[model samples]
Target: MTERRHDREFVRTFFTSPTAVEGEDDSAKMLRRAADLRGLEAPDVWVPDNEDATAPSMREEGAENVAEVVADSGADFPGEIHPRVVWHRDDPAARYRGFQQMLTVADPDRGAVDHIDGFVIPEVGDIDDWKKADEALTLVETEHGLDRGSLAMSVIVESGEAELAMRHLREEVGKPTNSLERLFLLVDGEVDYTKDMRATTPTGELPPWPELRHNTSRGASAAGLIAVDGPYDDIRDVEGYRERMEANRAKGMTGIWSLTPGQVVEANTAPLPPETGRWLLSAGDRRVELDDRDGAWAYDGDRLSLDETGDDYRLRVGGDERRLDAEQLREELLGLVEYVPSMSDVVDSMEEFEAARESGTGAIAIERAATLRLDGVDVEISSDRMWDEATYQAAMTPIRLFQDVYDHRPDQREELEERYGEDVVERATTVG
Candidate 1:
């Protein structure tokens, strides 16, 4: 079966740290905490400066030394958790050496290379640097007998030139390599970027770098790569951190680097927009309705037409269409609802959900009920029944008002308050 991409999708809380002794154990402890956090993917432990001048002479020895410390600290966790070592970007030959050392320590039993997932290259100022890093990594992989796609690589976009380089690499040259998966935006690069832009503010607030943040996100998305926001340096300012995280999340960033353990919870708990829930529901419904039969199917103003040709099926969905075998179609359909739990599982877990299912309500109806309950709306009846019953509708009057307020349509809110009492406007807006 084709792996469901949604299985890989979640709030990525990457806890990064320098390889220093003072907070090394503290960092590991946070990694363990992150592993246990619900709705969070495996934590990424990023160790920078693996190939720099101050790094150990033998890269394999350095990796093993770090592994020993990680294990000794009792922070090791199962699943996809892995450490990414950052390589120096100035010299391709040095990076190649580091990659070779990284591979030499790839002993699954020792939890060395097995847990060392990828490498990060810092200060990639142009497409040439990116291409060179790719070539160096590829050469190392070839020499060490590592699979070409086994290790993921990410570049740090720390300056204006680095941002432009990313755009050029994506548009002009394509991905530097197949293994390069993410472009990390270092918004707080102290030396080159901050100095060049004169971004420091007198008030000491987070600098207004909307252009940098937005462009980094756009460039990553355009290249089909994950965009990771840099750490918020002011760890004590929780509210300010949250605001910045929300801004980045809105800009299509998949993840953010957490400089401290305190930031992880806020990072994980950041609310997705209400529209995301709506899209998931719509997509789930479409997936459930998909069948192997060759015919036209329509849902949510989108149409999917399937035609059988020999052993293959030509499937057309909206503007994009492709041919695939029956197995492939099944996998495609499954991918859409991979993140969504099965209706049976939902019913088994929640009494309200079970009651809704027993009443002959569909998945979408149950989803609506669950969503409403999560939004603090009391859902005693199934969504379908609530729509039909006048008394139930009366009970949901406040909820509908609040939803309208949350939706933020001025015309709709004006009409709603005029129809219902204006008192609802205050109640709706203030309830949350």
Candidate 2:
């Protein structure tokens, strides 16, 4: 596998604020502010937007603004910087303008090239169109005397053809002459996609294309690229943005395009596991929260009971009681206890697994026991989860992500210390 030039662990938020605005003395004000952000406010990937976000007449100045802002302040900014340049599949003039802009911003003398990670190409058509964009970046890199395949190319899937292009990426990227291996992110452009599909809603708002998001995630996974959902237009609707993120997270898409600093803060923090662990139990039609005490979850409510047989226990549900043994009880509780593991829990589990591994234990099963007061009976419950090498590696991802944020956002140290405590913060940064 080819190693990535950029060493980003996890990209939770991709912030794309407009680069240039008309009539403003400082055309790059937004871009400058984004570069100045530190701590929790900073996004994992920052895109200086010169495409749809900027006016057509101001795109040239917008490109200059991208180069100037990053050249001035990007060194201190602890995030990957990628400028979004304009490009259309059918418009040769627009493509040429975008190519020129890329050349301007990517020139080594501009000083921004050192901080720039790649370029984001929007409105791509098919696999061929995507290759054309890749080829353009190669030409730019060659002209600027940079290393070949250094500048990664990310594309926006705005049309059906562009969405379909993702299916062929695995095959196309394996070719010797193809630089599609440098592709980084597959971002969705919902607005234009809805237009292209002639999709309409009663309110005329863009419909939630869950299928598109799923395809993007699958494509990214197949090609080993990062998948990012498109921008949430209602910037003030914080809950709505979070709901959208939850849906995206379910589909294995953790990154989202952020339009403002506030959205960046929300997006950056949403994907990380919760700070504390809690349990939820499924009731008739709803989920009930169980109390956590002394590292175990307990519940004492509703119509339920437990009857002990000779060698098995019967758990009551509404009116049905099923006889279950200890192992079966563990399985039942495992299904019932939807626990969102805290950072501390993950770290502790990982440490235990590591120690076991050092001791030559190939695998281990962890047991979590709890007690429930159902009706008049006090019944004990437990769950066992198996952990192996593969499981440990998967669990290490969030820890690595935490370390990445802690390393990059020095300004957020105090806040992180407050949330996770000094010891946890230290271990989190050092453990993985």
Q: Estimate each model's TM-score.
A: 0.51, 0.86
Residue pairs with colliding backbones in model 2 are: none
Tens-place lDDT per residue, model 2, 1-432, is 233334664578889888899999898888888898987788888998899889989899999999898899988887788899999988878788889999999999998899888999999998999988998999999999999889988899999999999999888985887788789999999999998899999999899999999999989887888889999999999999999999998887889999888999999888876788777887545677777655445667765555667788888767767898877865775676576788888888888898899999989997756665444444566667899999998888778778867776667678788888888777777764
| Candidate whose TM-score is highest | 2
Residue 139 of model 2, lDDT score? 94
What overall lDDT, based on C-alpha atoms, would model 1 receive against the true structure?
0.48
Model 1's TM-score against the true structure: 0.51
lDDT of 1 by residue, 1-432 (tens): 111111133324556543322225443333334344332233333443343312354344445555554444323442233344444556656566656545544434444555555566666666766666666566656765677646555666766667777666445433544434333222324334564566777875556677777887777656655566776777898988887877876686646767665675566445322211221312413543322112212233335455667887676665678887766755554343222233222222243433445697543232222311111211121123222233333334324323532353232344445544465345444432
| Candidate 2, superposed: residue stretches over 4 Å from native | 1-5, 291-335, 371-380, 404-415, 429-432
